[model samples]
Target chain A: MNPTYFLLLIYIIVCTLIITYWAAKHSGTTKQYYIASGTLTGYQNGMAISGDFISAASFLGVVGMIALRGYDGFLYSIGFLVSYNVVLFLVSEPVHRLGKFSLGDVVCSRFPGQKMRLIMAICTFIISLLYMIPQLVASGFLLRLLLDLNYSVSVLLIGTIMTIYVVVGGMIATSWVQIIKTVLLMSGTFLLTLIVLSNFNWDLTLFLNKVEEGTPLGEQFFLPGHLFNIPIEFLSLQLSLVLGTAGLPHILMRLFTVRNTYEVRKSLISATWIIGLFYFMTLILGFGTVALLGYEALIAKDPTGNLAAPLLAKVVGGDFLLAFVSAVAFTTIVAVVSGLAISATIAFSHDIFFHILKKGKTTEREQVRSARITAFIIGLLSTLFALRLESINVTSLVSMTFTVAASSVFPVLVLTIYWKRFTSVGAITAIVSGILASFIFVVLGPYVMNPSDGLFKTEAIFSLYNPGIVTIPIGFLGGILGSLLSKRIKQKETDFNSFYIKAQSGYSSRGES
Target chain B: MEEKLLNYIYRKRKRLFIILIFALLFYFFLPLSLIFIPEIMNKPSFLFNLPWAWVYAILQFPMTWLFCSIYHRKAKKDEQELDAIKGEDVN
Candidate 1:
């Protein structure tokens, strides 16, 4: 590794550590560790949520896809942005006001239980672990490209650093870093778009005309073969993107960070604008990649298309832009992983350990410690999994994780919010059913598995596979089934009303405002 | 008789929830069959460089809201009944 590249890596670590320590100093309460003490407003929290939600996979993956396949890549962006509307109208206030921490808190707040809480936390952990794997894998992949080093070394290194950041800092570090990460992600995308658009001779129509002249699509900037290319398997891919995004757990967790229902609605609108604008820019960036870099250059330089946007930067803006894009990519991964680590830790420490083991009386200091420690433990496990399973596409796997979230968390959450009769029994059943169905589909479903070449081989169950449409209904059905069986089913209307108020007015000031 | 159903829908949430779900299912399987059907689901739209599948993906929200709005207006009306049940509205 060149001394400068190494220096840049060191710079990121040191800066992150400083930010972590600063956040740690102020975050001295249990509330602080869990929901940032409910102090963060919707706008700030919205950006942090976006930063957390976007992740490396989105930051890197979508750009790469658009460059490779035309308009299909924008589909991910649309799914991600559009889902929040469902969140705002559906879940914002209920989730925010009902919980101290953990999604289980929201689900179990009205219903009495160690049983439901424990079960949901267990579900959260499994789903979170599944979610974290791709982040670690992406870290490894990114490091390999950045330093020209082996992937495993990068994974271990990123896993360790992320663990330390989450363990020491708590939610404060997670939110702040997420903020910085969002800035970097947005700025990097913006700058790259500018440089690429500059080279397009200012005519998208003309530019696409040239691309279509050469490629199968007959029009390069736009999707070919009927406005947007209808792949033979388009139906499956569509289900995955649309339904999968609706139910993601980590993304859902972001809504709870805000202070009120109205803010949640507002943030939804803002996030849509931000995400829509970003996807729109990606169109220009993707075409610019083909228009300027050309297919031959892309294949030779960035066969993975992972580096399409970056390579475009290098071509027009030179090696400095390359270095900058790479640095932003590093920040992108760190920002997201840091949030993931913090979220996992909070779910474990607050939801499983303290609230379950000692009841809700666990001191703020103790809660902080557990949260930090949990982050470390979760980070370590995810790294080990990533190291073992090397061949998975870090980005596509994220969509699967989203599918699980949409399937598992979305149903229980939405059902609880909207339906009067969603019993605890129902919540538990839904979670288990959704997870089991998705898990079975993932393992048994036919996917082209690329086994890792021997360095501790790992096999993925289903890829090019989206279980959202199938699993989300199963999740809904599970809750329905659970509710039907519960002896105390009439309590549904009471639970629903209180939960609605708690959710709508939970974090707000005293009395109905 | 039908107007009462309309009035109830415009006023109550729990009742409207059932209606919205029914509408969505209808939107998914029948009238909007072209949206989610195998053949149509395979297509993509190109406004803003989105895919044809995106036409459905992008449209699903407004469609959901369109259905929800019918119920939301009803839910608002039903909320008043909630006050009546509590005897708060009787005075």
Candidate 2:
């Protein structure tokens, strides 16, 4: 093992263990296990929120994409940054006021049925699991690259660390890990940006000109359609990214950690600013990679451009900076995987096991214990699956999570909050159909069924890579049609009135208790 | 009191919807417009040797933040107005 890699890994492990040890004491109760007992301030929650949203894919994969794909990669960053607005304007305040543990909590608040809860739990679990695989795969790739470990060993190591964090320290540990990682990621990117700028004597124009010089694509690098030429495909991807973020179980769960609607707004605004600035810095780093490392060299280093940022760091600031960037990337993956694990665990324990199966009669201790066990199981399962999926592009796998989220969860959550007529039947129908539609589309789509390497070994029937453009509307229609055709639940009106009042105002659901 | 709160929520929701729609439209305008007018997609501007697409891509970061800030302020103002109404009712 390289000494620098070994030392940096040791340092990161020590720091994370220390933070996890301190956070373990706060994980005794279910509330603390899930949402940190709703004690996080706006600024702290903002940092955690940004940390949760800006995954290793966004930091490493996106910068890599921009370095390779030019303008298209920046479009991906914008999709992510602007998607927070969907959460901010539509989901955040309602979700903060209504939910206790997960998105299932908010849905159950309006519907109050075991079937609805189970459906929501299943949707959350699937989305979280889909999202978790990419993070774990990214972790495996990073560890294999940085530490020279076998891919399976790296996958297992990441799974073990993530399980320990979630099972021992829960959301408190997860949030703190994310918070620290965000700080490290932002500062690291900022430093890299500074170095890159100084290399060009802080002249962005000179840097841009140099990036285009001697490149095969030349001026075409700065234009769109290089990666995604088709208009519909680009639109579909943009739709999924912007809308899917609000429905991501891990991101949605972050909203409940704040105190009120006001804090939700504050947290989102702060998160937006932090993430925006981070993306801006990523642009600098991406261009710098092309300028410093050259396009062909970057592609030679990593075909997916995932290594562009780290490679740029190594070239600019030598081995020490490279080690630092690699370690930060590792921790970033850990933080994200832990968050995904906790969300899946919460769906199982709070939504399915406690509420749906036990009819909400379980004790807090039982709930917390079940959550820990579920986290371990999920961690193991995702690790094993990730080992098999080592060859797939991490960013592409991550985008599939967004497609499922945008289709299944986004429509249901939006309708539940805004549409008073939405019933449990409607919610169930929307989630089930939405998930099935998107899943079927992805499996049939070009990503999975390309003639060369796809499982089916034929041309894809579903031409679009992302299923959002087709499935999102289907999800909304399913909810509407289901609600229209189902028998009216008499209590829905009164329930809607109460939920509306609480959601629109800053009224705490806990206050009534 | 309930009627007043309902009215307040109704008006605020409408305003919120309008603002959110505008933000979404503004954010999507670039990509959608590019589809319609592909000629301008490669139009060169004064920002170094970067084309219009690059400038638009870079501007999205600040524009996203700007819309969020606007929505934040508007939402806060709505909340404060409702609180003042509640205070009057208590008085």
User: Best by lDDT, which number?
Assistant: 2
Candidate 2, A386: how far from true, in Å? 2.0
- lDDT by residue (tens digit), candidate 1, A322-426: 777777778778777777776677777877888788797867777777776777778888888989988875544565576677778778877776676678778
In candidate 1, stretches whose alpha carbon ends up further than 4 angstroms from where it belongs are A2-4, A213-216, A220-233, A392-396, A448-464, A488-496, A504-513, B1-91
Candidate 2, A199-235: lDDT as tens digits: 9998878898888872567878888777888899999
Best prediction by DockQ: 2
Instruction: Give the docking tier of candidate 1.
Output: incorrect
Predicted candidate 1 versus true structure: per-residue lDDT over B47-79, tens digit per residue: 544445445545644554455345345434444
lDDT of 1: 0.66
